[model samples]
Target: MITVDFSRLTVSPGDRILDIGCGSGRHTCAAYRLKGVRVTGADLNPEDLKEARGRLTFHDQLGEHGGGAWNLSAADVTRLPFPDACFDLVVCSEVLEHIPDHDTAMGEIVRVLKPGKPLVVSVPRYLPERICWALSDEYFNANQGHVRIYRKSDLIARLERAGTRFLEHHYAHGIHAPYWWLKCFVGPTRTDSPAVNLYHRLLTWDIMKKPRITRFLDRLLNPVLGKSLVLYLIKRRL
Candidate 1:
């Protein structure tokens, strides 16, 4: 599922877009479908890169608006391989919390982005994430799992320190918070449980069908219990 809103980001044809830490390529796929932009998915995991590559054959399936080239690379966010100021847009969704030296990573993101271009960053919102931490230590301690919980203000302050101009922020995935709470209660790995399985089905259906009921409910609940906090930041011209 994509966290960053393309409309809010205002992606244009021919913009170069990068999705850093692009696990499984959900947002990468979204960026590729934007008409005429060039999209790249970079990740630390080869398997997820493979999944992204394999999924490209289906880009034609994304329809007329799906009109962009896709590139996949394995790279460290703190040490990106691209030349400076090359990308028009960069997405760092659900990634900062996983890095121990996120400040360095954020600096690298600013370096690669064109001056005045926006970087879309997202993390688990404080309250929902705090609940998850309270529910299970295993949740945050797993390998490659989240290492920090971010308050919105703290995250904004961090971006400012990284030399980006703060633009705006929003909450997302309100419907998924309860699903995670249920998982934490049962066991993070207990997908076999009936409740968890049923909720997964609901999420899958919502993704595929986009039925009105759940959409309405999710929009209504987003401000109160949203699972992710999304930030928009612009690189300052040197």
Candidate 2:
């Protein structure tokens, strides 16, 4: 689901990009594959950074998985190590809600991105996230997991206040809302449960094969039931 929409974050060769909360390096890998853009994937957790580095261009076909041309850094989003205006693209997918200091993070994101370039911010949609929180204490109670939820408008308002002049916005991953609800209802960590296991298998199949039946269904249902809201913003040129 992410890969499809993420392709729109296009870049030319040598374009510098930053994956500020690059968990698992999915977006970072894709950027390398599509263009020879220099990318830095940064995260606060050393463990996630290590795992993300290992998967980057490791053992995949030569032409597959973004060609492994990326640098991984252990760093915090609120305080980036790089200088100002260092990247043409910045992506903070599924990471903002976890930070209690979202404003600081937003400031850093804008600071690093070259003015007029695009920033893609993705968060769990309000309704789907609320459902998960309502269903289970473990969802947000983990403390290490999501700390807050975001509405598209709320997020946009923050970016605007931070001086990021966004030009457009949209929602994505509508197919995932139910899968998470199922997990929350069954048990977020209890993938072993019969119902949970079945649902996981179905989701895996759906992503891999992308059957036409489900494709059309998701297109129809996404506006109402999408799991993630993707906000595409641009930093006004100085």
Candidate 3:
């Protein structure tokens, strides 16, 4: 479920981490568990934010999830409520493609991150996403689901224009692409379909159990047919 591997990404204890557009606070939970990070979960969905906060609180009391040290806030990514150079690490996974003013949002992220801090961004890869779009009209038509599709080269070009210097990029979640194509073929919102249901169960198991066989297959398949392309970036200190 994690796109940015914190260990490989150079995240350290005590770093102040920001998760912009943090739906359900998956990143926040992980950050909190990373030794001594000060994690903040920011999102536009008050309902989701509230639910995420409740989940964190429950886990903390249960001696699980983060062990009681993370923050949650509801805010627009374009107009973040943090001061300049406030965060040591920033995560904007699967968010930029949805925003019409992605430049502004990127600027806000850069403004808040300290120099040399890497920002991780993830978006659906062009081919897989385009296939989904071709498979169903409902896939990209939902109001806030996804506003734009991104090709890797085009996305990197965009980041360059937005003032984010891309350092590296990699693909992930290859196993989820075909499942989504199936969903789009059936119906984007219709999760009750037998096919979708089956795939959902498989994905849940893959995420939770991470069976060795499936993980190996996913790794081999990821580069060629990955669903998401994750890019690492650094905000230039000028």
Candidate 4:
């Protein structure tokens, strides 16, 4: 499911977009669908990069990329391989909380993004994430799991210090927050719980069908209960 609202971000033909920590290519592929853009999906995991490449290739086979070019790279967010000021847009979703040196990653994101270009960064919202952490330790203790929980304002300030001007923020996945709370209560790894399974199915249906009722509820509840906090920012020129 897509989190960044494309309508809030401007895109022009020939713009180059980067999706850092682009697991499974969700946001990367979303950017690729824009007309005449060049999108790159970069991740630290070779396996994830492989999967992203496969998805991009599948999109090409289905003629769904809107004539855009795409590539996948195995790259660390803190030490990206691209030249400075290379990307017109950069997306770093659900990634910062996992890095111990997230400041460095933010710096790299600012460095690679063209001056005055936009960057979209997302992470689990503090309240919902705190609830999950309180409910279950395993939820945040897994390998490569989140190491920090950021209050919305703190994250915005941190990014601003890294040379990006915060524009606005939004919350997403309101309905999914309850599902995760339930999962944490039942044990994050417990896939056998019937309640968790049912919730999972409901989420799957919502993502696939996007029924009007769920959509309305999601939007209505997002400001308070959304699972993810997304921020929009623009890199500042030196």
Candidate 5:
């Protein structure tokens, strides 16, 4: 399930794209399928990188890559390995809230992105995330879990301060918010709850089937109940 809206951003053949904290290569593989783009999926976890590489290889086997080149790297967001002004586009989704030094990571993203290029950043929405935190400590207290919750205004200000100009914003995963709330209520790590299990199956079905009713409801409710907030920005020219 891709969070960043490709239609809102411009990507062309030969462009280089970076997916920071690219857990399991969801966005990385999405970008790779754009045909002729060079996509890199970078994360701090070696295991996640390995998984991403496997997924990318699977895409290659299935001929789903659209002729794009791809690579996976184990890298920290706060101190990336790429050269300055090297990437045409950067995607940092569901990642910043996990980092204690998110400001430095933001700066690194701007440093690597070419001036005037687009950057997409996403985080859990404040209301939904706050609800989860209120519902259960385990939701946020788990290892590598979210350490902060971002109000839309604060997040936009942060990225703007990091040398990116905000363009637009949107919300996503509206239907999934309730599923998480249920999990938080039941117990974040518990798998035995029948309600939670049922909801999980529903979500999995929606993701795989893309039924019309669920899609309509998801779009309808996204404005107010969306779990994820996605922002679009462009790096400032020096």
Candidate 6:
């Protein structure tokens, strides 16, 4: 499920893109399909890195992948291996909350992103995430799980402090918020229950069918109840 709007980010075909904390390489694979971009998927986990590479290889075999270059790397977000001002675009989705030193990670994003380029950062929205935390302790207690929740303003302020110019923001996955809330309510492990199973089926149908009703409902609800908050930032030359 692609959240960041490529058009809004104005990605050029040959642009260099980085997907930091690229677990399972969902977004990185998407970028590779953009055709002609050099895409890098970086994560601290060796397993995730391996999986990302495997996905890229699979895409290449199927001929569904792009013509551009793509690679997977193991790297820390707070201390990235890239040179300063290297990438044309950087995507850090659902990642900041997992880092204890998110400010340092943000600084690295700003440092490696070329001046005037875009950085897309997303996290769980405060209210929905707060509700999840209240409902289940398992939600945030896992290894490498969320350590903090960020209000929109606080997130923006921190990015600005790290030297990124605030551009704009949006919300996504409104339909998924209730699914998670239900999971939290019943216990994250209890997906076999009837109510949760029904909801899961509905979500699967919505994702597969893209029915008009759910799409309309999600658009209406996203502003108020989106599960994720997506922020756009630009690096300023310092």
Q: Per model, how many backbone clashes are there?
A: 0, 2, 0, 0, 0, 0
With a 3 Å backbone cut-off (N, CA, C), the pairs that clash in candidate 4 are none
Question: What does candidate 2's lDDT look like per residue over 1-238, in tens digits?
Answer: 3522655655777888898888777777766665567788899888888887877747254556444367899889999999999899898888889999999999999999898888888888899899999998998855258999887788999987876876665666666778778888877877578877776787787777999877877778778987777788888876
Tens digit of per-residue lDDT, candidate 5, span 1-238: 8899887888999999999999999999889889699999999998999999999999999999869899888899999999999999999999999999999999999999999999999999999999999999899975268989999999999999999999999999999999999999998999899999999999999988999999998999899999999999999998
Pairs that collide, model 3: none
lDDT of 6 by residue, 147-169 (tens): 99999999999999988889999
User: Residue 146 CA error for candidate 6 (Å)?
Assistant: 0.9
The alpha-carbon RMSD values of the candidates against the true structure, listed in the order shown, are 1.4, 2.1, 1.8, 1.0, 0.9, 1.7
Q: In candidate 4, what residue range of length 10 has the lowest lDDT sum?
A: 137-146
Residue pairs with colliding backbones in model 5 are none
* Backbone clashes counted, model 3: 0
TM-score of each: 0.96, 0.91, 0.93, 0.98, 0.98, 0.94
lDDT of 1 at 193: 98
Error of 2 at 207 (Å): 2.7
* Model 3: ten consecutive residues of lowest lDDT: 60-69
lDDT, residue 34, candidate 5: 92
Per-residue lDDT value at 152 in model 3: 82
Model 4 lDDT per residue over 1-238, tens place: 8899988999999999999999999999999999999999999888888899898999999999869799888899999999999999999999999999999999999999999999999999999999999999899975258899999989999999999999999999999999989989989988799999998998899988999999999999899999999999999887
After superposing candidate 2, which stretches have Cα over 4 Å from the reference?
1-4, 59-61, 65-68, 142-144
As a TM-score, model 5 comes out at 0.98
lDDT per prediction?
0.89, 0.79, 0.83, 0.93, 0.93, 0.89
